[model samples]
Target: MPDLLVKLSWSLLCLAHLVPAAALLQPSLLVPLYDVDPASGAGLLLRHRAALFLAVALVCAYAALAPDGRRAAGLVVSVSVVGFLVLYVGAGAPAGALRTVALTDALLLPPLTVAVWSAWRA
Candidate 1:
């Protein structure tokens, strides 16, 4: 049988990433998502970020079902989440939606760890 925890974790990651990825097609989402105007440079960069997030989501969806791909998928997801949290904290941890973003990533850490551990044991 497939590992349930891996499936759940990767699936969650896929969905989480897809939310931001949608901003690629719908730039207006940036306003509600991060309060940035779509015409601004930050908005342009955030749109690019959305595309990158789509790539991660694709990888996660694939890995959720493919055992051989789990390690790489987990690494990619972990690095993305952890790197964002670290950078955000280092930047003095500003308030607002970004802090919510960081906290969301922080909350995912435990489940991610459990998934990786279960896979390793298997």
Candidate 2:
């Protein structure tokens, strides 16, 4: 039962990441990799910010309350690191910008995930 819940929570977190990365970041960041117009990219970023934030919030809540939070959190943190690397290298963005984003994700996600998992197990 706990395992299922943990897996579900992890899945949700993964989903949340994908939603924003695809809808928000790609249009703004990835498009620019291909030399798309900055204006259009900004438009996507603006349009999806709220939805993206909402998704992030939902996943955060799930991660906090689910069992196996430690493992889930670790996986999510790994996902973010992998995501940033993919975006940074695969997209051909500047190293500093990618590193900044990657580091931000690393700092924000792991601790929270662990906290939530601990709460759930306790």
TM-score against truth, every candidate? 0.91, 0.40
Model 1 TM-score is: 0.91
The per-model lDDT (C-alpha) reads: 0.85, 0.51
Best candidate according to lDDT: 1
Candidate 1 deviant stretches above 4 angstroms: 119-122
For candidate 1, lDDT tens digit of each residue in 1-122?
34786688878888888988999999999998888998999999999999999998998898888878877877888888889999999999999879878888898787678656655666
lDDT of 2 by residue, 23-113 (tens): 3444554443333343675555544653554455455556545544455555544555456657776777666444565555555454445
Clashes of each: 0, 1
